[model samples]
Target: MLRPALLALFLTGATAPAFAQPPTETVPLLREIKQWVIGCDNLRNCHALSAPSGVDEEDYSSLTLHLWHQAGPQGYLRLRFDHRGEDVDLSTLLLDGKPLGLELTQDLHIELDDQGGDPEVQSFGGIEDAAARRWLQRLRNGQRLQLPGDEAAHVSLSGLSASLLLMDAVQGRLDNVTALSRPGKGAASEVAPRAPAPVLRKFTAAAPLTAEEQAGLVAAALQAVKPEEGEPEATVGALTAQQAMTVTRYDCAAYNCEFDVSSRERQAPYKETPMDLQPLPLEDAALQGSVGYDEASGTLSYFYKQRGIGDCGGGASWVFDGKRFQLSEFHRMPRCTGVGYGDWPALWTTVPAP
Candidate 1:
């Protein structure tokens, strides 16, 4: 059974756009290219980021570059940089210790934002397609991409050409003028079209569960996981003294309270099988995470943390229809490169069904 606090933590409404129905080819691809990591979602939207040489280093010292591109022929490329550490003149970026002579303000039309009230941590974005391609072309043959001034931070260009080549192939941009790695006179029309995001219908008319109904479902879920006769009960807040001693070995306050109940499974009352309790089905069979249900919105959610740092994880949510729980959203981030949870790529997405 979920504690009131735990229920409140997990059952809160998700403001992110709710999506539904898994795409026929929703499996995303992730690859590591020598200090750089790249991933593409089902929609063919691709993201590549530079990782620290020391994988365990949490602070992204001077600058981290991220590249994003949409899947279709009309899709454009964009570049972003997150800067930390000491102040440096980003306008004078260097490739192989030589200045590229590119005008950052005019070419990229960059925008800067100070994140988390940290004056030292600034983010820059909005690199134009033409300028981005020019920069990529110049950097691909270089060994290091360095920021000018004291504390000259740099990212290795090793495997960059291969990474861009793979992106070109994945988006079917090879031999086309739009190809970032291998451009030719071929027209953009030859590139593959972007795949449509899957749609899921939410039963908005479904009535909210009453207090009695919620309590009954919770009881049923607890009973489902109850131990056999003479065995120790695994139920929360009702543990025996010995069981509590074993369970208290880990400090929930220091780490995360969600870890205590994340491994436990819960059942919901399915209208089709009112006589029996049924576990809600997830689009991905591997997501064995903490489960939560909202009585108000009739949404069931599962969240799995790759580690206690919360830097990497995946989550999915479903809105309950009259008959069953319909998948509304699914997202995952395979790399723990200091990116936030909201920044994860979406494998399955949906809009409310009309």
Candidate 2:
């Protein structure tokens, strides 16, 4: 029952953009790298997903990669293909120029109430399976992966390592399981089983932002992105709060737009002086982007688009603990091209907790 439900939410996003609805906690976008987007639900289960660009929505839905993890036996990497409503034979899955053997007793067929044929989804290696465990290790080591049919097709392993780190932050003991489950390796001679992953705390929305409250946020945003030519001044813009504690200041000057975040409920007194925040590198200062908050996970996300079309963008996000914002994760992609969204091959890194 749980498996089918999880697949529904994940597959639904394949044809169209969708997130976990109410009753299911969610981190809207924990991380996105090229075609891959990693997200988590209230249950602490995380999915590393990818759907290539330039394909029909329904056709693309069946063609996807979902690496799932839940801190225990419920972890694995699976590939799904729609097959245009036909039975298909799958003998082996190839990754990084290597073939992973699979046991297929019969042709795979996915028919929803004998309706239109759905793509058949197959697992590469399960959490407890030796081959699956090995594949995970290779992925974390930054190895490239390719689908079975296309010899020229390859998926970059960039940011996968960091995305897993974010998943571990939500769930617990994933690092431990990976270490112990290393392929061709035995578990520690004497080790206790890890406890199950923790469920995320549910969040209740606070009062909606008032017009004045929104104004204060705009003022703060101006201060964050204002050029250093003169004193910071308030600018006209709109403020939208994705969550009670999270508000984004969106303002566009000419053809350029800027987004800044604020955690306070009300805007502070207008200050000619600047607020204390880390300055982004000179090269990344001019990109257009926005910020979002995931109330369920208490994570703050900052995203930006690179100057040209292709894979050349990056993101910086933090976790807020009432008092301060701590660096949670960051990604950089300097050499990516031909990507529709302007994000290229990138590397994701996790900031060690202080």
Candidate 3:
């Protein structure tokens, strides 16, 4: 779920409807354009356009979108739009692999089909007609669109009028979006926050966690819990040697899938250097429950909480999808183990960027 505090961000802004601006006289002379060549799925005139069969517009999540049109007989126009609460100011637009110079006095947020395909290019009388045709035509193709990225492109005058007029000629408001409906609020909610990934080891030559340091870690973990609820408190088993420890193999279907989680007790710190004892405890921080993971999208997430001396507590985690096997998350607080918290000098990690 999205953080409740961020709800305010999704609320539409109170900006007044833009006033109609007269097209600059020079615009009538420009011919470049910017647009997102959408797949002709659910389009009223889908059968009219010459396209490969079977590559239906219905199945795709990505498309090539750009904005850079050049100056021509028509005046260059820049296009800008608000995207996910951010402004996309583009100087150029790329439509169907072609480029064009653009200039936008006001923001123009519109959606362009990112579905992979041979971008159709024909001709355009100028930039003004191109923009109008580019955006207005979406409705006829059975889709209402908002400005997407700032990418721009050059428009073929012949295709510009045909496509734009086709869009303007027909109108149908999409209510139930299955395969061809325009994206809506429900679409936004489907977005998921990415889980943490396995990260590079950061501890090189660091002092082991002392009794006090272990306690500090427990404190930090508890504090990180949001809303002050579901606090994963430290437990004695977490600091005991006989705490529950399981090592199961996982078949992750997606990236960032955690493959394994390992935990064991240690008596003394390892004699080897910190780097040599990676994904293990080498310090004097007695801890139980060390999280472990195999594959990571990026940063590895590791945790250790100790309740007392000669005891350590921690766990490792990785991203795992149910493609092959799945690793479950710890739903309960960890117990203490007899393992000395020392030798805890190392943890699962990956290199980090600046």
Task: Report residue 315 deviation for candidate 3 (angstroms).
Answer: 17
**What is the per-residue lDDT of model 2 for residues 272-343, given as tens digits with 9 covering 90 to 100?**
222223333323442236556665545666666554432346666555444344454444443332232212
Candidate maximizing TM-score: 1
RMSD of 2: 12.4
Q: How close is candidate 3 to the true structure, as a TM-score?
A: 0.21
lDDT at 280, model 3: 26
Superposed on all Cα atoms, the candidates' RMSDs to the truth, in angstroms, are: 10.2, 12.4, 22.0
Lowest lDDT block of 10, candidate 2:
14-23
TM-score of model 2 relative to the true fold?
0.39
276 in model 3: Cα distance from truth in Å? 28
TM-score winner between 1 and 2, please give it. 1
In the range 288-353, model 3's lDDT, one tens digit per residue, is 234332322311234445443323344433332211111111111122212222212112222232
Each prediction's TM-score against the native? Answer: 0.69, 0.39, 0.21
The candidate that wins on lDDT is 1
Go through the candidates in order and give each one's C-alpha lDDT.
Answer: 0.55, 0.41, 0.25
Evaluate residue 240 in candidate 3 and report its C-alpha lDDT on the 0 to 100 scale: 22
Native-to-model Cα distance after best TM-score fit, residue 25 in candidate 1, in Å: 11
